[model samples]
Target: MPRIPGGATGVVLALLLAACTGGPGDAASDEEAAQSPADPAFVADNEAWRAERRAALLEPDGWASLIGLHWIELPAHYVGSGATNGIRLAKGPEKLGMLQQQGGRVWLVPDPGAALTVDDAPAKERIELLPDVSGTPTIVAFDEGKGQLSLVDRGGRKALRVKHAEAASLTGLGPLEYWPADPAWRVQARFVAHPQGKTIPIMDITSRQAPQPNPGAIEFEHGGAGYRLEALEGEDGGLFLVFADRTSGHGSYGAGRYLYTAAPDAEGRVLVDFNRAYNPPCVFTDFATCPLPPPENRLDLAVTAGEKKYRRP
Candidate 1:
């Protein structure tokens, strides 16, 4: 399995080759030069973007740091590293506390002797723990702020998402792999608006389905073939696309990849950059609840750009 989501991997030889000689020599260099735009600014911008992407992944609380995911099925659970606890944590004090789900809210009663924090403040009593659905999940920090636990709601099911700075996945993460910086993968597409309030049922990795906003679709021609991707709402009015192509499981993430297109212009034109396509969070960690591509978004074309599959350390 891949080690990181929003990421991909290269064979061991290719990774070592990339680390030592910049890349696989002549053929790789030729491919990059042929697909790159003549404008130096394009390459510079892509480089800047890649640097920022790596920075995000390296953050202490980034996706790579994820270590555990525990479901909350009962009304109450004694969470701790102790074997006797109902919800045994992967890491923490032997007796962390009691988690009680009452009505629609969740509360945590910390162990008096356990050093913990609720939203960074010292925890000494029971406190309301907000779920992610509230737009601000309460962060329960332990291990001297190196470990964090947060409540997440997925399709009305609740789970504890755990992360630790010293996780093997983070410290042992390998270098990112890619097909190369290709300008040709950046194509201009037309956005076709959907009916007002249209929604699509999207299934996540957990097999739970939920209706998500379907604001529009992006239609583009790649390699002389027509393709359409149902667009989901994105940050700042942009478009979020989850799709699978011929490259899936061959040279990319098997589940699929993700892409973001800026809001369409007045003329309904937008640029879809396949080079910026990325793997989902599930690619890196099993704890992630990433959405799979809907049937309508699967394409037959081989998109030989963007991220390759991720190799774990």
Candidate 2:
């Protein structure tokens, strides 16, 4: 199969999805053509979105930049790059600081002359480090601001997430492959609201389970079959869907793919755009604890749209 390399322009769209070919008069191809919006504006918008997505993944602190994730097991431990430290970092000063967890709070005491910054400001003394759960996690930047260390709390377990500007995963990242953008994959679905205050147990790649807010389910029809995806609360009150189709491990990411939908309209309608589906952070780094798709979200259908599997450079 021919893969579209990263940084390619929109002109290459005609050459996409070479593995899934069909004759010009094929029934499926005709149906997709009929459903596809020919508006130049739509094409331009999708192209722009793809450009933004590529730029985000290539950012210095993006998902591909992840280097390590060190769990804080002991109450207090030395954190640095030296082998003698209790929590050795992949990249940083030999004696970066001391991480201590007291009660329910975590604190970082920088080493003298280590030249660390807390949220971009100089840090010379012990500082309380906040986790992502607080909606504003404290960032401890070192190595001339190229290395970022942040505290993340997952299912009550806290750990240090590290990222570097020059991580091999980022510098050597391969292109993002995708199925051809077919409008037939964009279906308008119905949102069935779940009982208020309901939550669902979500398991991550690390095997830790946590109950996340479950607002509702998006019910849609494709290829004459009905399907449903449990929707989690997403950014700005949107709906986040993590799902696996028959393509998993065949042509797409083995674990699953992520799709985001705008908030349902007053009439309970949602535009489920499968073309925007993307891979999770786990695809770019092994250190990420990405969520697994719940059984209810796994579909037997072969969704031939959205992102394909990622290949390392």
Candidate 3:
């Protein structure tokens, strides 16, 4: 529930506080006061709001616990040795199960009549066994040429397919801390135009290759340091970014954290608020494969804004 800058509640609070102080007969004046131009205090309040959200994202139960990753290869056999091998199930001592591959498709055989379910639906034949984050047996089926899967559970919910693997935020945990939130990190960045539309490659927890759309980069300045962030287009059309700054490795998440921005305005402008940057899903579980920021996305300067590393469970 940490607030991000420009969040909705802050606007409501400002209006309510104004009403409490204004005369009942001067409602129009109160409305005008609320609509007045932004002030220095308003900017400070926004920064504080962003800081709260930053902290919440890095908190335990956030997305950083991902610590294991495995890929489903052709002839998907479940190997049970070593830490990074095949799928690590929460089942019994057997540790490993049987997997078969035929016609470019893979399937798993749960212990005979294993009370398994896919997305809460009763078990079905010829379906893919997926990791169950909800503590139930789940299966998934993929379309012929599509990268996504159709997930089904034991109870019957068809949910979006997701993979399990150790995320960078989970593995790169050293000391969970952050630099103080300095307003200097809040800067107006210019979005560069990329008419051709760039493509950024991402490797999921399964080490599967997925191509993310890169619309362009945001250029900003902080404390005499200049930085650029390359934007990745989310499946929902939102903006996503994986970036590393000077504090990475030593102070921030080694693989890097994520940030999002709304679509650009008519003038093609957006605020690259570092105060809202947060840890990736890998920070909370070992079942998330988060993409690391590419070399070009690594910034040489320190960005002292947003949440620090997560320290508590």
Full-model lDDT for every candidate: 0.78, 0.81, 0.50
Ranking by lDDT: 2, 1, 3
* lDDT score for residue 242 of model 1: 85
Off by over 4 Å in 3: 1-68, 73-97, 129-178, 201-211, 284-287, 311-313
- Candidate 3 to native Cα RMSD, angstroms: 15.5
Model 2 Cα RMSD, 1 decimal: 8.0
Clashes of 3: 37
Residue pairs in steric clash, candidate 2? Answer: none
Model 3 lDDT at residue 271: 72
Q: What TM-score does model 3 achieve against the real structure?
A: 0.58
Per-residue CA lDDT of candidate 1, range 58-78, in tens?
A: 788898889888899999999
The clash number for model 2 is 0
- Scanning candidate 3 in windows of ten residues, the lowest lDDT window is 141-150
Global local distance difference test of model 2:
0.81
- Which 10 consecutive residues of model 1 have the lowest summed lDDT? 1-10
Give the winner by lDDT.
2
Off by over 4 Å in 2: 1-40
* Candidate 1 local lDDT, residue 204: 72
Q: Candidate 2, 238: how far from true, in Å?
A: 0.9
